[model samples]
Target: MMKVMAFVGSPRKGGNTSKIVNSICTGLKENGHAVEVYYLSELDNVGCKACDSCQANKVEYCAINDKMTTLLPKIADADCIIVGTPVYMLQLSGITKNFLDRLFTFYRRSNHTARYLPGKKYMTVTCNGAPAEAFGNVTEYLNQLFNGSFKMKNVGNIITGNLTNKDDILKQQGVLEQAEELGRKLS
Candidate 1:
């Protein structure tokens, strides 16, 4: 079974984004894959400071000692990663952006290494209050961030749109099913 690190990037705990990620994890677990859901809202995460300490001394890890620092090791060991976020102002949420920023350390140190997180697979889940098509920009942003910046293989992206209320996503049977289906396929 694959070990998947699932990150819920929405600040609203158990919000629409979280539900979508949870659905994916549920399917992964059913398929016998180990899933760890990291809730950013519950952790005290400071945005990346661009200190480059991780590049200078690999042992120091990320310069900031916030919750994300603790996750570095787990992320390094995971076979796959899943990131879910709600689109804010036509972009990824602030927390998600910060998390992505922190990954720059890997980019800095592994600039010449083709195997940097080479075997790992990843997928993105994005939700928006506007039409689903509006999420294309953010979806492409994440895809390029992970696929190009990190050099990780992208499994796929799930975008749920037109969800203004908390329950809007859960009420969308197709999106939830898509999330689960995506997880199953990943497994």
Candidate 2:
């Protein structure tokens, strides 16, 4: 079974991002794949230190000794990754941006190449308060990061909008089902 690491970028534990990620995990679990879920806010990471220690291979992954120290290794070992976030100001949430910034450790600054991230499978989920098509750029940005920059394979993406409430995703049962189905297809 493939190992999948799912990250919820929303601080709200029960928000749309978390719910969709949970649903995807449920499907992955049903398919006998190992799924580990992590909430960004609860991780308490101090964000990236920009020390380039990880780039220098000084400490393995960014010098910060927070939860990311534990998670970066997991990210490297996992076969697939799923990132879910709610759009803020037509961009990724601050916590999500910080988390992505920390991933700079994977890069080789000399040649702008990443060793561990290439060939990894990745999926994205984006929720916005605007219309579904309004924030297409957010998903494209994520794609550019994971697919263009990292050279990871694009497994899928769930870009949706008009979810203003915390539990707004619950009402979109169809989207939740699609998320689960996406998970099942991975395995």
Candidate 3:
């Protein structure tokens, strides 16, 4: 069974994005894969300082000691990484964007032959206040970030539309089901 790390990037706890990710995790767990969910909003994650510390002293280690630093080992070891976020300002939520920025550590590491992570898969879930088509830009950004930057295999993406209210997404049973299926297929 593959170990998966699911990151919920919405700032609202138990919000639409988190609910969908939890469902995905449930499916992965049922399929005998190990899954761990990390809520970015709950973590004290600082944006990447662009310091070359990770590249210099420690080897694959970011110097920042915030909660995000705790994720480096887990992210490196996980076979699959799943990220879910709400669409804000036609892009991923600030929390997710910050988390993505922090991933510069991985990007820098991969630039040299000493890539810490390789052959891993990634999934994305985006919930928007508008229709799914309206948030295609957000999905494309995530796809490019995860695949182009990290070289992770793009497994799939689940987008939920019209999710202004956090609980509004509960009405989209199909989207949640799709997320569950996406998790089941990850490994």
Q: Number of the top candidate by TM-score?
A: 2
lDDT per residue (tens digit) for residues 58-175 in model 2: 8877678788888888899889999999999879999998889988988788898987889999999999999889988989999999998899999989988889999988889999
Residue-by-residue lDDT tens digits, candidate 1, 24-133 = 99889888899999887776777877666877765545878678888887788899999999998878898888787777666655454433466689989998999889
- Clash count, one per candidate: 0, 0, 0
Alpha-carbon shift of residue 153 in model 3 (angstroms): 0.7
Error of 3 at 101 (Å): 1.4
lDDT winner: 2
Candidate 3, clashing residue pairs? Answer: none
Kindly report which residue stretches of model 2 are placed more than 4 angstroms away from their true locations once superposed.
none
Each prediction's whole-model lDDT (CA) = 0.83, 0.89, 0.82
Q: Is candidate 2 or candidate 3 better by TM-score?
A: 2
The candidate with the higher TM-score, 1 or 2, is 2
Worst 10 residues of 3 by lDDT: 109-118
- What is the overall TM-score of model 1 with all chains considered together? 0.93
Error of 1 at 105 (Å): 2.0
